[model samples]
Target: MTSLTIIDLSNNRFSGPIPPNIGESIPNFLYSLLSNQITGIIPKSIGYMSHLEILDLSRNSLIGSIPSFISNYSYLYFLTLEKNNLSKTIPKSFG
Candidate 1:
């Protein structure tokens, strides 16, 4: 939202956190807050956006893990935080 490119506040029942400077203020687009009710974690400065392609924070209530530099950026194709309450082990730069 810092200069906006393409953001979707999906399902629009927003909760807390997620505003961890928001990739240092929207550094390129395609983002979604899917099925809101958002909680904590996933911040890690969102790996500094770096012209991100597509990202979805699926189903809210996020916890920890999956940060792994968020697939080391490199123009993220499409990332979905599926079903919420994140835990360890889905890292490997996510496909």
Candidate 2:
């Protein structure tokens, strides 16, 4: 999985919180879990994926503020998190 560059699991009808160790398993350039039943905070370990360029967790049941470390992804250019229960203003560095 270390060689993987993208992962898209959108609209799979999957449920449950995203595994906290996902970043350790697949540090890819793009990740998407859109339109699922996923609930819980966006895993902080995702910040470890320095090469991440696109992330889409939209239309899920996720809750919690967007992690601050997301702003550290210099390569991240596309992010879609709409329709979730996330709170708080986005990190200033992200904009």
Flag regions of model 2 displaced more than 4 Å: none
Model 1 residue 18 lDDT score: 86
Residue runs of model 1 more than 4 Å from their true location after superposition:
1-4, 14-28, 38-59, 62-72, 76-83, 93-95
Error of 1 at 35 (Å): 7.9
Give the per-residue lDDT of model 2 (tens digit) for 1-95: 77899899999999999999888778899899989999988988887889999999999999999899888988999999999999967989877
- Give lDDT per model, in order: 0.84, 0.91
Lowest lDDT block of 10, candidate 2: 86-95
Q: What is the lDDT of residue 34 in candidate 1?
A: 96
20-57, model 1: which lDDT tens digit per residue? 87788677678899998999898888788888889999
Pairs in clash, predicted candidate 1: none
True-vs-predicted CA distance for residue 65, candidate 1, Å: 8.6
